[model samples]
Target: MSTTGFDYTITRTLDAPADRVWAAWTVADEYAVWASAEEVVLDVRPGGAWSSVMVIPGGARVPLTGGYVEVVENKRLVMGMNVPGRDEPVLMTLDLTADGERTQISLSQTFDTAEDRDQAEQGSNFLLDSLTTHLAAA
Candidate 1:
């Protein structure tokens, strides 16, 4: 893939409603159940802060901090991510569309540099996959 693009996007059709998926992402306890984080603190509204501490195998902790730029219940969300050691914040948008009893999500993360975007892709995919599993267990 070319490193010129400013955003990297991933789309998934989940076997759950938009509201359910939205709650899973926005609620601290719910997010912790599905995400790759050992701890989560989320305030689901514009200007609110969202943070998590991810614990990798063998006990390495990686902290992530972000703030909500925009939020629309069960529909859309835009957040800003402050990557460790990076001066610029990465922007992420999550759009949800209802599809009968299911939901289709389009997630896009825009970075200041291609290197940052590329580095984030792998973990993003893992989180999405975890979401799928979490929904299935519900």
Candidate 2:
């Protein structure tokens, strides 16, 4: 299915450089840490594929698969994530801006319905919170 527009967007500033923030998304090990994934494989180039097995609460494992549509180093990334139970992959765009020692990140995702988008916001916030913690420790 084709998405008309993004349904959800969230922005956060992290206490880390843009490069580091980018690594957290592009690097397998770093992504695994913050994403709470059992395994992660990332190919951070245009048209490259990425996959991860996320370990959710109660020991359930969920597989996430995606492909990179665009990559601009520490500046921007756009990908399509195949969420379970969805007919089409969700388009995700992440933009990063470096402000001295901090990085401002804006993430947008497209969903088919407003209810789905609203429900996903909570999970997105939790994921970003994990990223913040990982960055702080790094």
Kindly report which residue stretches of model 1 are placed more than 4 angstroms away from their true locations once superposed. Answer: 1-5
TM-scores, all candidates, are: 0.89, 0.91
Query: Which digits, one per residue and each the tens of the lDDT, describe model 2 over residues 1-138?
Result: 235743778999999999999999999998998999967999999989999999997999998899999999999999988877878677788999999999999988767677878877878888999999999999
lDDT of 1 at 111: 66
Q: Pick the candidate with the highest TM-score.
A: 2
Question: Per-residue lDDT tens digits of candidate 1, residues 14-83?
Answer: 9999989999999888898888686799987888998999877698898989999999999999988887
Worst 10 contiguous positions by lDDT, candidate 1: 1-10
Model 2 superposed RMSD (Cα): 2.3
lDDT of candidate model 2 versus the reference: 0.89
